[model samples]
Target: MARNGRSERGATIIDVARRAGVSAMTVSRVINGRSSVRPETRAAVERAIEALAYTPNTAARSLVRSAELRIGIIYSNPSAAFMSEFLTGIYEEASSTGARLVLLKGEGGRPPAQAALKRFRKSALSGVILAPPLGETRSVLSAVRSWELPVAAIGAYDVDGVACVRIDDRSAAFEMTRHLLDLGHRKIGFVLGNPDQTASAERMAGFYAAIREVGGVEVKVAQGDFSYASGLVAGEQLLGGDERPTAIFASNDDMAAAIVSVAHRRHLDVPSELTVAGFDDTSAAVTLWPPLTTVHQPLRRLAAEALAAVTAAASAGSTVATCRAKILDHSIVKRESLAAPLGGADARSDPDA
Candidate 1:
């Protein structure tokens, strides 16, 4: 139907094929994202489609389809390993549902968050999922509200009304510490992450809880910012303290590796002289000499759960408010990094003695 001839509802693919001088089948292949269409042919098909204002027939197809897709993932992390792994979950989940992952970079602080949320509305993304600390923020939560977008926060700490897919951080930490205590590690030191981080706080509570359960064992807690340098700085002080712990539980593997490095420099033998453990069984945990005992979080699986939850929420036409928390299990991975303290005079003796 020509624009001048009649008031047609819309142009069809036949109109594009006629203008491009290609068979209707070739035009259909290009439009459907099928392979084997030549570059020149694809280009001509696109041009003719634009010229005729031809949109796809997905509307009719969608009526028969049982799925709604195009999921949006929001990450406030600096482009890094953790974020990359999180996105892998998003992609895998989206693929299973015949959807695409529309990732949003929310790296900057509050101002960036506002701008990112604003830009999010301009796109055709269906639902949004928040990762970690970002999901725990007041500003981000408020922004999510103002944007009128469906948002699910993965790894949320305080979820009064928020939807989250996270693990029991406090319980995980408690269990890991209890495992060490059961192995006869009484005088254990802790290298913690930033106080502002909810996981760090929860993990610290777990360590202290274990100490309280056994009664009378000293707890030396060092502050770290979840970085190698922070670990190095804090670890040195803890290692050189008057009552050095026989075993040190770092908040994460990176800091644990730093503790291991510091121990090596001081000529302290691992497991034989001192034992070290860490949380968040990151890659470095297994690579350290003798490796590290840590709590293994199902990062990828948790991520998939978060994405799937968001997908389900959007597909069900429910507000993100309707979504609830999901808890994943964690495991304790033991390697050579843990052992009974060296006997008597050689084992973690007091500096003042």
Candidate 2:
């Protein structure tokens, strides 16, 4: 039974199905974590897999297939820092798997994404990966699904029939807010990301949740489109007022860096007169004078995971059926940008400090 020093008669999906007394499709559904499968059926499939030592041959299938694997990436995110890290992840993964990547800039609205999908329809693309904002766009998702292309979404949550990879934005934001609160910052300002993305809403929700947990805290909200320019405007609005916040948390590092710039212009010492925090530990977070205390969102890993999921689904020739959601981990990164307020826990009494 040995071939090339390995077992030639290795277990396959059919073998697992036969051992479990179920159809191959049922086994596949169980393997992909589809909710439609009954608990008993899922358990049986797991038991069969364990007993037979059956492993899905994604790599072998890809190698045997004649068509080259081409993956399309459509993105419209405004943050350059975020995109740089995201593309790095995708490139790294593609190089390892020998998958070709086709890039498309979806700057406008649904038209760009839809147009990209239309172009990909004729390009022999094996699958597509939609970056944030575009990933959450209903029109774009519907259009891609209509074309019957294997698709995965990055930074989007709970999209039916699509493989999704993201961190818990709400939870991450909540933890970051808690960190500021623990540092004795009572008056805090928040800079929001683009309104079109679901992550913006989730992050805002987390900020409010933490704020609600504490009483008598003053909070100011400003809008930013996750761009450095937008961050500058938001930072000005937040710091220009007479009753300024003791700390500010931006939705992303770009905005946080902008806030730092604004603070320096106003002669405020970071972590002394004012504390700043940001989400997504992108390049901007560390490059600034004082490193940002922020949420560590694995932008590159998210992109890589999404690409891998869609490519694997395409390899199996059942993208929609095999699509699954994966939630990655996020952590709070502590750095010099955050500290206790100037007057510590009693800073609120002065307000002008």
Q: What local distance difference test score does each model get?
A: 0.71, 0.83
| Shift of residue 253 alpha carbon in model 1, Å | 1.9
- In candidate 2, what are the lDDT values of residues 225-282, reduced to their tens digit? 8888889999899999999999999999999999999999999999898999999999
Candidate 1 has a TM-score of 0.73
Model 1: residue 215 alpha-carbon error in angstroms: 2.9
For each predicted model, how many residue pairs clash, with residues at least 3 apart or on different chains?
0, 0
Residue-pair clashes, model 2: 0
lDDT of 1 by residue, 45-75 (tens): 9999888888776765464244456666766
Output the TM-score of candidate 2: 0.82
Q: After superposition, how far is residue 146 of candidate 1 from its true place, in Å?
A: 1.8
**Runs in model 1 lying further than 4 Å from the true structure:** 1-68, 77-81, 106-111, 344-353
Model 1 per-residue lDDT at 206: 82
